[model samples]
Every structure is written in structure tokens, then in C-alpha cells.
Target: MKIFLTGLGFVGSKLVTHLIQSPENQLRVVSRSPSATLPAGVHFEQVDSLEKVINWPTLIGDSQVVIHTAARVHVMNDSCDDPLEEYRKVNVRGTLALAEAAAAVGVKRFVFVSSIKVNGEETFPETPYKADDVPAPRDPYGISKLEAEQALQALSSSSGMEVVIVRPVLVYGPRVRANFYNMMNWLFKGVPLPLGAINNKRSLVSIYNLVDFIGVCAKHPRAANQTFLISDGQDLSTTELLQKMGRALGVSVRLLPVPVSMLKLTASIVGKSGISQRLCGFLQVDIEKNRRLLDWVPVCSVEEGLARTAQDFLTGRRA
Candidate 1:
């Protein structure tokens, strides 16, 4: 199977590593930099911009599957005047352009690595989000992803190109960064956090599990034209997650049982409502579709995944 991959970021690089382990997969990666350290026997192409017009037919030639992992991710301290348009330029326009080119070149399947935010920012305690839920993107990043999914679906409908969309929750693993990594760092340092009272449930996926699922989707016959909501198949509260992280790091966490309502009020007063919401919000996904339809299960357990990540962080493998 000839596979063309985009974005050599954390997820893309890991996916490349996993795919190259199989001799049957002929991998080609596109990066903006010429100095990317790709595995042996894999081909590389350099492209300055995904939104710019390029020779797509040649780029996607002989590739049976195109896995798009490149996107304009969420910007916390955005400086742009119109963040949505900025995001659209890369995530929406660039993604659709690549898909169009891949379809034009007769790619067998297009696997789009989407975000769970497309379903919504948060879910209710009793009601988990299903794959078939109507999209209600609240943020610019989520809106862009939803638009890209819609565009890909339209393209797949118009053309005969099979499309598989995987909306994954917070992906954490060896090279993990952002809020999850920060939480791990806080746990490693035994920082007392005001999240003991946060009983909100959040679903997360390990990078290993996500890459495994992508590999399955790449070749699974039943995955064609399907949208999947993937997770670790386990929901955890903020306190539980921090405690697990502490255990992974071989340390004990100190959690302060601050009132959830007081925390929200203080966060709102300090203009940190977003952070508070993420720390005290419910965001669970129902991954039954992936399990039942494709008979897929997570390759790494949450504990194992967290341990690996903590070990990597401790050893300075991911700093």
C-alpha cells in the first residue's frame, strides 16, 4: 500500500514511524523543511504551503491512501484580527485542496485526522457524544474542522474517492505537549492543584492507540466513507487524571478540594473562564462505532500510555 502523509508534527511523525514498521507500506511524507529525519526506505517531498497551488497529481501519484494530519490548530493567544479566516486558509482550504488533488489522482482512500471539538466543546454528564451527533462547533478551530469534514464529504460524494474521518479526543503520548503535558509536569513537581472537587468527565486518546486506529482505518474495508469518534474508551475526572499522572511519574499528587462553583467564579473574575471550563467540564465521546463497526480496540491502555509519557518526560526524551 502506497501512503502519502502530510504534517510531520507529533501525531504525523508517530504515525509515520508506526506505518514504516510494516514492510508492506510504501510511505511518502511531505514536509516544509528539508531536514526532517524520516525513517529509512521512506520517500520525502518538500512543499512550502499546502494552500498554495501545486502539482497534486504528481505529489499523490501511485499513493493508494492519503492521510491528512496537517491543520491550523487552536491558538490560545491569537493575535490575528480574524482568527477564523486565518484558520480557514490552512485547515479548510488547504485540506480540501489536498483532498481534491488526491481524489483527482485516484487515491483509494483519504483519511482525515479531525478533532473531537467538531462535535462540540463539551458534552453533558449523562449524554456522551456519538459519531452521528449534529455538529455544533463553538470555536474557530472546531468550526474549521467541521467545515473541512463537510468539504471532504462533498468531495467524496462527487468523486468516487473513499473518505474516512476520525475525530480523536485529547491525544497524549511520549511527545505530548500543551495542557496535558503541563498537567504531567505539575504532577511530577507535586504542585497542589485546585481540581480535587472537579468531577467532570473527559475522554482522551493515547497517541499509540490513535495511530493504531489510523493504520486499521487505512486498510479496513468497512472504514470507507465513515466518521469515527475515537477515545481511550474510558472517561476520567480531572482529579483522577492528575492522580494517574502522579502514579505514572511515581509520585503522589496534592489536590486541593476547592469548591467547583467558587473556582468557576474566581476564574471568571480573572478572565480565566476558559481554563476553568476545561478543567471542570464534561467531554466524553461514545466510541462504540469504532469498536462494533471495525472491531477495533485501543492498543495501549490509559495507564500504560500515561506511564510511557511520564517516563519520556522524566528522561528528557520530550522536553
Candidate 2:
């Protein structure tokens, strides 16, 4: 089978690795630069602009599936004057362009990787998002992702191009970056962290498990026109998460019991209430629908996933 992937960021890269491991798949990647050190047996092209998309018509015309994992992730960089507009350009417009291109060429299926934030950043106590729940994005990134899902569904209706959307929460493991990186740095140093009093529950996904689920969706007949919220199916408090991470790093926690209210106040003054809230707040996803629909369960526990990540960190196997 021929599979085309757009985007080479963190998730995209991991997806490519998964595809390469599949013996029956021939993979092609499209990006702005074609100079990536991809695994053996993968093809590439450079897409300079939305108008300059390569012979995607011909490429996807013969492909079995197209997995769209490329996007401008949430950023605090200064280049974004209007974050909403910036998100729309790439996450929404670029996504539609790619989907339209695929549809034009008669691609069978298009799987979009979306964010859990499409439901909301923080999950309330009694109400977690179900597959049938309407999206309520609270940030530019989430809004763009939700908009893209809508566009793809419309395209699917008109062109008979099957669309499957997977919303994953806080994917972590090898080749992790940003927040996970900082978290690991602190854990590895055995420094005292101020997250002991954080009693909030959050859901996280292992990159391995996420990629595995995507592989199932790629060919599963039951996955057509479906949307899934994926995680390890384990909800954990922030303190429990930290403790597991510390254990994986072969270190004991030096947690300082600081009050959550004090942390919130400090974060607000510094304009980082969102990040602080994520570190010290409650956010969970209900994955029962995914389990029931696809009969899929995470193969690795959180502890096993964290151990792999810790090994990657110690052995320099990932960045």
C-alpha cells in the first residue's frame, strides 16, 4: 500500500517511523524542505507554498491512505502577531488544501491528528468529553484544529473521501520536546519540585501507543468517518505523574508541598497561568468510546512508557 504523510514535526516523525516498520507500506513525505534523514525506503518532496504543492494529485491518486499530522503547534514565539490568524493559515487553510488535493486525486482515506484541546484544555469534574460531544476549543491552536476537522468532514461528504479524526492528549515518550523536556530536566537533576500539593488529574499518551492506534485506524474498516479521543486510559494526579517520572529516572522525589493557590497567583503575575494550570490542574479524557468502538486498549502502561523515555534520555537515543 502507498501512504502519504504531510508534516515532519514530532508526531509526524513518530508516525513515519511506525509506517516504516510496516512491511507492506511504501511511505512518501511532503514538507518545505526535502533534506530529512528519514528511515530507509521512504520518499520525499518539497512543498514551497500552498499553490506549489508537488504532484500530490498523482501521488495520492494511487495511495491507500493519507495521514495528516503536520501543523504549527501552540507556541509562545513573537512571530505570531495574531495567534488566531496564524493558526488558521496553517492548521485550517493548509490542512484543507492538502485534503482537497488528496480528494482531487481520489485518495481513499484521510486521517487527521487533532488535539484534545478541541474539547477543552481543562476537563471539568463530572463532565469529560465523549466522542459525540461538540467541540469547544479555548485557544487558537484548538480552534484551528476543530475548524480543520469540520472542513475535512465536509470534503468527505462531497468527495466520498473517508475521514478519521484522532484527538490525542499530551503525547509523550522518545523525541519529546518543550514541556516534557523541562519536566525531565528537573526530574533528572533530582531537584526539589513544587508540585506535591497538585491533586489535579490529567491524561497523557505514550508516543508508541498513539502511533500504534493510528496504525489500526489506517486500515480498520470500522474507523471510517469516526472520531476518537485517545490516551492510556489511565487518569493520574499531577503528583502521581511526577512520582512515576521520578521513579523512571531512578531518583526519589524532592517534592515541596506548596499551595496550589500560591502557584496560581505567581503564574498569573508572570503571564503563565495557562502553563501553571496545566502543571497544577485537572484535565482528563474519557476513552471508553474508543475502547468500545475499536476494541483498542493501550498496550503499555504509563510506568512502562515513562521507563522507555527515561532510557532514551539516559542513552541519548532521542533529542
Measured with C-alpha atoms, the lDDT of residue 183 in candidate 2 is: 86
lDDT value, candidate 1, whole model: 0.91
Off by over 4 Å in 2: 33-35, 49-54, 77-79, 317-319
Model 1: pairs clashing at backbone N, Cα or C within 3 Å: none
Clashes per prediction? 0, 0
Best candidate according to lDDT: 1
lDDT for position 288 in model 1: 92
**169: Cα error in model 1, Å:** 0.6
Model 2's lDDT to the true fold? 0.85
Backbone clash pairs in model 2 (N, Cα, C under 3 Å; residues 3+ apart or in different chains), count: 0
Residue 287 lDDT (model 1): 91
